[model samples]
Target: MNVYFLSGLGADKRVFSQLTLDDQFIIHHIEWIKPLKKELLSHYAGRLVAQIDTTQAFQLVGLSFGGIIASELSNIVHPEQIVIISSTPTGVPISKFYRGLVKFLLLSPFAAPLLKSTNSLTYKFFGADTPELKTLLKDILHDTDSKFLKWALIRMSSWERKTRAENLYHIHGSADRLISIKLVKPDVVIEGGGHLMVYAQAKQISAILNKKLKSEEY
Candidate 1:
């Protein structure tokens, strides 16, 4: 069997570097494509769908925003299993305060810079306190396009998945700052884990996948 990994926003395959999978499965890393200047979610999902190889059966594992994309992709082609890590099935409900904050940021170009300056704080919130991890995260963020970042954020805030897929299985961190664990009921919850749980708890994820794949074969 083949496993397709969809990395989180502002992240690449390197985000899953700690993962160790069994030899029974072939791993394929899907890279994010630049969305059009102003593209609809359906259009973006369609483009992502085009990247998959429909000729072969495969399972999908997606993290954060990538999980949302994976859900959209699953609508196009049924995967043996669809796993969502540190992600929620529903779009985050934006409160009035958050809406105002988003508008404020949009009105002030300097807002992005201000937010960038707080990277260390963000790192702490995500439990990435180690110097090496912080440096790696900074490098990842540096490579990310601001426009894409804003677009993805807006998309996620406004997006909703109406379809409750039976194949879907969620694995979340109890302390995820980005997505609230209270808002979601995952198949598995890792205590003390944060937004970047996939990186922090890769071996556990690998083991879960291996077990799931084995059970499916029987």
Candidate 2:
């Protein structure tokens, strides 16, 4: 089986480096493309799907923003299995107060300044509490384009998965701060693991994929 892994927002292929899959599967890393000016999430997902070879039997494993992209891509091809890690099928739930604040930022050009000020909060939300993680996060944030950041933030805030496909599986961490675990029904729950569980619990993800693949093959 061929497995395509999609990384989270502002992250690259390195996020899945820790996952060790069996020889039965070939892993492909799908990178994110810059969203076209004023592009919708569905349209962006279509572009992402175009990067894949849809003729083969494959599995999709996505984390965070990639999970949402994978969910949209799943409508284009029927993969043997679809696994979402550390993400929600429905958009992340926003509190009433936060919703207003998000709208204000997304609607104004001052969004970039606001985001810069929240770098520390972003680090904590993504489960990067260590000094090293904080430094790495700062670098990532610095490299990100402000326009793209604003677009992604608005996209995430407006996203809604009204209908889910069958055979969809979710693997989430109970301690996720970015996306609420309560909003999703995960097949597996890793206690104490946070939003970056894809890195912290890669072996467990690989094991789950192995078992699921074996079952499908039989």
Candidate 3:
């Protein structure tokens, strides 16, 4: 089976560099496309569906904001399963405080630049503790498109799904600061893992994924 991987907000395929899966499964990374002005999340997801080869059997694996995109895509395309790492199954996980904050930032002229800048606060929020991890985080942030970041943040803030997608598997990090564990009930919880746990705890997460992806049950 083929598995399509979607990276977090403003991130690329590098986010899944550390993950290892069985030889039987082929992996493909879904690249982010430019969003139309004021496009709805559902419509944006519809645009992304052009990248997938739906003729064959496949699954989806998304991280952070990409997870939400995966959920939206699931509604449009039929995937065998979808696994979201360090992410929530529904929009309820995004609190009202975060929504208000995004709205406030959208009005500010400095929002895009500020969000694209790599800083100590960004490191702490992403839990980039190791030197290599910090550098990777910095590079990802530096390379992110400011417009896309702002647009994604706005879409995330207003996402309104109330139920989980079918055959969806959620893996959360207990120590994730950006999305608190208290906000969601995940299928698998990585203890001491942070927002970047997919990279930091690749070995453990990879093992879990291999098992889940290979199993008959979703």
- Best candidate per lDDT, number? 3
Candidate 2 per-residue lDDT, tens place, 1-218, comes to 78888877777776677777788778888977889988998888888877788888788888888888888888777777778888777766667678778868677877776675536678778787667556656666666677777877778887867776556788889889988777788888988778876776778777876777653662
Model 2 error, position 88 (Å): 0.8
Better model by lDDT, 2 or 3?
Answer: 3
Using all chains and alpha carbons, the TM-scores for the candidates as numbered come to 0.90, 0.86, 0.95
lDDT tens digits by residue: candidate 1, 145-165 = 666776777677767676656
TM-score of 2: 0.86
24-104, model 3: which lDDT tens digit per residue? 788999999999999988999999988999998889999999999999999999999999998878986557888888788
lDDT of 3 at 45: 93
Q: Rate residue 54 of model 2 by lDDT.
A: 88
What are the clash counts of all predictions, listed in order? 0, 0, 0
Pairs with steric clashes in candidate 1: none
Kindly report which residue stretches of model 2 are placed more than 4 angstroms away from their true locations once superposed. Answer: 92-100, 113-120, 214-218
Kindly report which residue stretches of model 1 are placed more than 4 angstroms away from their true locations once superposed.
103-107, 114-118, 215-218
Residue clash pairs of candidate 3? none
List residue ranges in candidate 3 displaced over 4 A: 93-100, 215-218
